[model samples]
Target: MPVNRTVNVSVVFNCVQNGANDFGGSATYTQSSSTPSDLGNVVDSNGNIDLRQASAYDPSQYNDSVDFVFTLAPQSTGYVTPVVWASRNGAGATIVVPQGGNAQEFQVEQSSATPQLLTIVDNDDDSNTYNYKPAVELPNFDHYYISLDPRIVNKPSSTNK
Candidate 1:
């Protein structure tokens, strides 16, 4: 698709009009690998694409343009196949992190006013383990730290900080 987007995009899932509810599928997309990246968390279980999670960039730079080819795979063989129900384009937002300040005081905020960046300087600092978390979470937070980038950032504190 010729997508000229810079914000979060979503694919609405629903049963086909012909009552082909038996067939369901997940959505995913692919991007260039010329730059270092990992797309482990960008995809939804119900087949949705978030272009931001498909690539990486320096905290101060814009995301590298990506060409996402959305794909759908049917869950089971049925008389009817899955079809697009609806799609919503994204309205881009900006992330602002304070520069040259106390790293501990600064934080990375999402489009909404929420800070989800959590940093564990050392295992001795807390009982929580970082083994289960991915190497890097989405919504880059290097712009907030003084010495190191966040290992687990952009995670809602209310959910798990």
Candidate 2:
């Protein structure tokens, strides 16, 4: 099987933007920690976080790997998408190594209409440069059972982004 080498990241002017038939109103696409992306072992090591995994992962483990977090108020996506969630490392917690920490997380917005086409966006630009890329492949990415879904989001997921 081939491996994911590059993840294309982009920003969203608005989730419920006046595009895609005004698929805008206030919508967001996200996957729970159960999804491979959140716990998946597809770290980029040198580049930004794997775009594929980021798109797949929900806020479940989001706080676990990133330093700062910022999300613009829901845009005009016009669809009531589900809320994807995971066990984030929690706020004010110091990030450790080996197990990874929130300091490595990246911020990216995506489209539930096409989960597979999930895009990466950076609304916050403090000390944040890029989403945290895994230094190695997360075992969860390849193996199942390593992590399970927390059943947070109720919306239907799109294809793999």
Candidate 3:
């Protein structure tokens, strides 16, 4: 039997005062188990977590989960709490964290093999309103793309006398 696996991702936000007042963010991932690794570091050369690589999994083999933890760096000025959303293939997005919510961490259960995309935005404007639409291009928001390739492994059947 395969054991369950968990992936931990750390998120950091930075506010840049580039005349236009821009925000920058980054994410990195680490797996819990190394014996049967199902995922790589997931961080691209640009120091961003891009899971669209070879993140393959087999539901029948093991259950996989991912946790995204957010952190506001000291340099992230004029920024309030963080809110998150998830969507697939340019469809409508679902709120993972509501505005002004006290939760700083969100959990994602990997049940489907299809690809997914998550967006994390800071409430820099301190507004209580939000639009849960995919690819809306909100300021101070970062995208974490996930692509899970399903792998089916066949097991040998047992023969009884």
Model 1 over residues 125-150: C-alpha lDDT tens digits?
A: 12121221111111222211111111
What is the TM-score (0 to 1) of candidate 1? Answer: 0.24
In terms of lDDT, which candidate is stronger, 1 or 3?
A: 3
lDDT of each: 0.25, 0.26, 0.31
- TM-score-superior candidate, 2 or 3: 3
**Residues 93-140, model 2: lDDT tens digits:** 122233334433333333434432332222222222232221111122
lDDT of 3 by residue, 50-161 (tens): 3333255564664443332222123234434342322433322233334446422322232233223232322211212322222212224443332222111111121110
Per-candidate TM vs. native? 0.24, 0.20, 0.28
Off by over 4 Å in 3: 1-4, 18-38, 45-61, 64-161
Off by over 4 Å in 1: 1-35, 50-64, 81-161
Distance from true position, residue 44, model 2, in Å?
8.7
**Cα TM-score of candidate 3:** 0.28
In terms of lDDT, which candidate is strongest? 3
Clashes of 3: 0
- The candidate that wins on TM-score is 3
